[model samples]
Target chain A: MIELRDVHKAFGSNRVLRGVNLTIPGGTSMVIIGGSGTGKSVALKSILGLVKPDSGTILLDGEDVAKAERDAFLARFGMLFQGGALFDSLTVWQNVAFRLLRGSLKRPIEEARAIAVEKLRRVGLKPEVADLFPAELSGGMQKRVGLARAIAAEPEIIFFDEPTTGLDPIMAGVINELIREIVTEMGATAMTITHDMSSVRAIADHVAMLHDGVIQWTGPVADMDASGDPYLDQFIHGRAEGPIEAVR
Target chain B: MIALAPLAAVGRSTLAMLGTIGSVALYAAITLGHILRPPFYIREFFSALLTIGYFSLPVVGLTTLFTGGALALQIFSGGARFNAESVVPQIVAIGIVRELGPVLTGLMVAGRVSAAIAAEIATMKVTEQLDALVTLSTNPIKYLTVPRVLAATIALPFLAAVGDIIGIMGGYLVGVTRLDFNAAVYLRNTVDFLETADVVSGLVKAAVFGFIVALMGCYHGMNSGRGAQGVGRATTNAVVSSSILILASNYLLTELFF
Candidate 1:
């Protein structure tokens, strides 16, 4: 289980996260939804200790993320960045096998390459795509490569950041299904942050809505439509006006 | 009141400059600190050496060569006023060994390597590749900055040596073919008049210039703002700052050595 208790983060006078508290049970998918710059990613990154919360505790399976050993702690988590974050200089397979070929998880080159190829196939990329660079791939393919690299090490926890942001609706749907299938099969805990309503419906088992630097609503995905919170209603329905300010 | 406004503007600019300088110094110190620590990335280091040192050979060599040749021509013409054109070989040797080789090599590499490093790193930051690196259990500075900085530091002296030698050869060609100096006499004058200290000081200047170039690149790149404009600004700043620093430090190093 991952728990964020009364998390607070501020950049200068701009209070990005005032007091955010949330929790996710083991092996479940929790998607946080919010508008632009409302601190959704900040809240998620806070859990990973990537953006440190000014004051609060982020506990992953009982221990504080800040207190745990960094490399060992990080090895348990995989992240798919919004932009795909694929290393442009390296080939697709090298990017996928990066973790296996270095640091504590070092493996023989051939073994690592084989695993990378398998992961690429797992993500629906062809074996031939392995030799190509990130620039050579399309946006959707790059996202798939990023996804492959994220799960390459078969980590215990996975974080997805705006995974469907830039893709066409069709490609986004494809990615959503793949994410759902992979997360379910891996049984790894997942915490995703996206504003894609379709993605919420497709990939989330539970949902949290962030607004005004706090979780305005969070519950099982089933209850989200009828949650009756004006803020959540305004957000989920794509309405521009509610308790939340539109332009802040 | 108008006078006060101008004064306030000057104060703001001064403070901003100082702040930037302080941050760069801190960054350099952090890079130095990381370089001394363990868990070094050997592959990244060698790759940096190849890119910064080996690949830079042609640009450095060619720039120094042309400058040396031009200097020979100018010096020969100027010395002709006194009928002392025989000073060509000695002046070319000293000038190439003492100043032009290191400074020109530094400036050329600053334009090439600094911009490339900044663009590559700023692009990494823009795409969140650096953040991904962090998540992958790698320190971006240790993985990126230290190797490049170390390679530049180690590589520049060798580059400067090569540039100095090639630059002398360029002057030799010019002196023999264009200046009508006896080839044997020119070679003898160059060999007899040159001192080891002059060559060593220039190489030292090159080393310092290399450190400045790579540091400016890493510093601006890492601190770059978001988007294409941000990365573009970082690249420009890297080249500009590295060039300025190389020239300024070259003077200081020369003063100390001389």
Candidate 2:
């Protein structure tokens, strides 16, 4: 289980996260929905210890992960960055099997490459694609490669930052299905941040709406349409006319 | 009032630059501290050697060769003014081994390797790859910086030594062919003038300059700000700082040893 209690973050006078609280139980997928600059990324980064919050307790399985031995704490989780930030210098297989080829978890080069291929296949990528560099791949291919890398170690917890952002609608749906299948099949606890409603519906077991630096509303997918909070409503429908101000 | 305005501008700019330098120093210290802690990545060491040393040979070699040739010409012409042209080979060998070989090679590698490491890491920072590494139970410093530092430290001195040999050969080519000096005499003077301390001192400078280059690259890259402009600035800062530090430290080392 992941638990965040009364988190606060501020950069000078600009407060990004203000007294936020959240919890995601084990064996479930929780998605946070928020517009750009609404602190969803900051909240996620705080959990990953990328952006240290001014004050907060990020607990993982009852241990405060924010202050935990970072490498050991991080060993249990995998992440898919928004941009599919594969190492430009490495081949696709190398990127996927990066963790397995180094440090305490290293395998033989051939073995690591084979496992990378298997993981690539799991993400619907061909074995031939393994030798290609990230620059040679299309956006959708890169996303799939990113997915393959994220699950390469079969981490217990996974974070997906805008998993389906730049893909075409068809590719996006495919990715959503892939994420859903992976999360369910692995029985891993997952947290995804996205503004894509279709993705939230496809992948989230629970949806939390972040607005004004706090969670405005949160519930099951069924309760989403009737969230009743105008901010949540405004975000879901992506309506121009609402309580939320539309930036020019 | 006008004089004071210029002075105030200079003062403010100096303070800002100092502040920037201080932050880089602080970041480098923290990174070094982290390196001494656990979770060292040995694989990255080989990778950095491949990146900083193996990949940098051609450029360093060429720079040293040309610099040696140029130095020979200038020294020969100056020596001729006092009927001292026979000093060419000895002066060239000493000059290259004592100062130019290490300093020029360091500056060249700094220009090539530091910018590359900084730009790559800065791009990783902007693209969230570094964050992904952190999430994967990897200390980015161990995975990234330590390896480069170790590789450069081990590899750069060897490279500098090679540059020293090639640089002397360059002077030999010019001295024997262009300056009408006997080959045997030029070789003897070159050998006679170069002491062990000179070469060792150059190698030591290479080691320090290598650390500075990698440290500056990793520091700026790790602390890079958001977006393209931030990365651009970091790349520029890494190259410029590494070069300046190389030259400055070279002078200090020269003064200390000589």
Candidate 3:
């Protein structure tokens, strides 16, 4: 389980996160939904320690991850960035196998490359494609490569940031299905941030709406349609006219 | 009032620039601290050496060679008034080792490597590659910054030394062929005048400059803003800041050593 307690963050005069708190039980998918600049990404970054919260505690499996030894704490989590963050200089296999081939996890180059190829194959990519660079792949393939790299280590916890942002609806659905498959298969605790309703329907066990730096609504995915909160209603439907104004 | 406004603007900009410099210094110290601790990435270090040092040789060698030749001609012509042409070889050697070798090599590498590292990492940050590394149980700093910084620091001095040698040779070639200096005497003068301290100082400068270049690239890329413009800005900043720091540090080191 992952728990965030009263997280606060500010940049100069701008308060991006204002004492936000939330929790996710293990072996479940929690999707955070929010509008642009609504602190969704900031909230996720805080959980991951990418952005240190001013005063808050993030607990993973009931232990304070923020206070834990960074590398060991980091070792348990996998994150799929919204941008697909592929290393352009390395080939697809090398990128996927990056961690496996270095430090205490070091494997022979051939063994690591083989595992990279297998992971690529798991994501519906051909063996031959592993030799190619990230730039050589299409957007969808890049995302798939990113996904493969994320799960390569089979992390206990997974975070997906705007997973379906730039893809076409068809590709988005495919990615959503793949994410669902991986979370279910691994039984990993998953937290995903996305405004894609279809993704919420496809992958989420529960949905949390972040607005004004706090979770405005939280419930099972089925209850999201009847969430009743004006902000949640306005955001889920992406309605132009609602209690939540289009502009701040 | 107009003059006052401009002065106020200048003062504000200066303060902002100072803030940036302070942050960079802080970032450098933190990275160095991490570097000293455990989880060092040795593979990345070797790879960086190959990329920053070995690959950069041709350009540094060529730039110093040409610059040395030109400096020799300029010094010889300037010295003609006092018939002090004998100073050409010594000046070329010192100038190449102290200034041109490190600064030009740093600038060139910054132009080539800094932008490349920043763009690659910023694109990763934007694209989710760095997050992927984190997920795979990898520290991005250990994986990314360690190798690049280690490579640049270790490789740069060798490049400077090579540049130093190549530059003096360039001056020697120019002196013997164009300036009518005897080849044997020019070689002897260069060897006799070049001290261990002079060479070591330049190498140390190269190492410092290398660290600056790689660190700037990683820092900007990791903290870069969103979208295309942010990555672009990071890349530009990395190159410009690295180059400027190299030149500025070169001056300070020179003063300290001399």
Candidate 4:
């Protein structure tokens, strides 16, 4: 389980996260939905210690994330970034096998490569694509490669940031299905932040709507529509006007 | 109060500059500290060595060669004004070995390597690859900055030595072909007049310049703002700052050596 308590983060004068408190139960997928620039990414990053919060505590499995041994703490989590964030210099397999190739998870080169190929196949990429660089692949293929890399180490927790943001509807559906299936099969704690309603419907066990630097509504996905919160209704229905202003 | 606005602006500018200097110094100290820690990436180190050293050969060689030939001609003409044209070989040797060779090589590498490093690193940061490295249990400083800085620091002295030899050869070529000078005598004069200390000092300077170049590149790159404009600015700053630092440090090193 991951829990964030009164997390606050600010960049200069812009307070991106203001006293955000949320929790995800073990072995469940929690999808955070928000409009652009509403601190969704910051909130996710805070849990991973990628973005440090000003005056809050993030606990992973009851351990304070900030105080944990960095490598050991990070070893339990895998993240797929919004932009894929694949290393341009590395081939797809090398990117997937990056963790195994070095540090405490070190493995023999051939074994690591073989595992990378397997993970690539698991992500629905051909084994032949392993040798190609990230630039050579299409965006969807790159996202699959990113996904393959994320799960290569079989982490206990996984983060998906805007997983289906740029894909065509079909590809988006495929990725969404893949994410839901992978999370279920691995039984990993999954935290995903995306605005795609389709993705929220497909992958979310619990849905949280972030607005005004705070979670405006959070509950099981089944309760989202009838949550009786105007902000939640306005956001879910994509209304430009309501208590939440559209313009910055 | 309005009349003093210019003075306040100057004060702000000075403070900002001091802040940047402090940040860079702290960054360098941290990088040096990390250099002694474990988890050294040998493959990354060798890759950097090849990039910073071997591939830089042609550019360093060409720059020094042309400079040396030009130095010989200038020195010969200047010596002729004092009826001392025979001093060309001695002057050219000392100048190339002690100063021009390393400075020129450092400047040329600063232009080529520093800009490339900054641009590549800035792009990685923009693309979140550095963050991805962290998520993979890899320290960006350990994997990226340390290897490149170590390679440049270690490789540059050797490059300067090669530049010194090529530079002298350039002078020899110019002397034998262009100026009607005895080939054997020119070689003998250059060899006899050059001191071991001269070459050693230049190599030492090259090492320091290499450190500065790579450090500036990594620093600007890591601190770059977002987008294409940010990357372009970082690249420009890396080259400009490294060049200025190399020239400034060369003067200080010359003073210490001489």
Query: Ranking under lDDT, best-scoring first?
Result: 4, 1, 2, 3
In model 4, what is the error at residue B71, expressed in angstroms?
0.6
Model 4 stretches astray by more than 4 angstroms: none
Please list the Cα RMSD from the true structure of every candidate, rounded to 1 decimal place: 1.6, 2.3, 3.0, 0.9
Best by TM-score: 4
User: lDDT tens digits, residues B179-235, model 1?
Assistant: 888999999999999999998899899999999999999999999999999999999
Worst 10 residues of 4 chain A by lDDT: A44-53
Q: What C-alpha lDDT, on a 0 to 100 scale, does residue B254 get in candidate 1?
A: 84
The segments of candidate 1 whose C-alpha lies over 4 angstroms from its true place after superposition are A246-248
Collision pairs in model 4: none
lDDT of 3 by residue, A65-153 (tens): 87788767777777787878777778999888877877556789999999989889888899999999988998899889888888877
DockQ of candidate 1 against the true complex:
0.78
TM-score of each: 0.96, 0.94, 0.89, 0.99
lDDT (tens digit, per residue) of candidate 2 on A44-100: 999988888898788998998856876667777888989998988789999999888
Query: After aligning candidate 4 to the native by TM-score, how far in Å is the CA of B7 from where it should be?
Result: 1.3
DockQ per model, Cα:
0.78, 0.71, 0.56, 0.89
With candidate 3 superimposed using the best TM-score fit, by how many Å does residue B213's alpha carbon deviate from the native? 3.1
Residue A50 shift from truth in candidate 3, angstroms: 1.5
Judged by DockQ cut-offs, the docking class of candidate 1 is medium
Q: iRMS of candidate 2, one decimal? A: 1.5
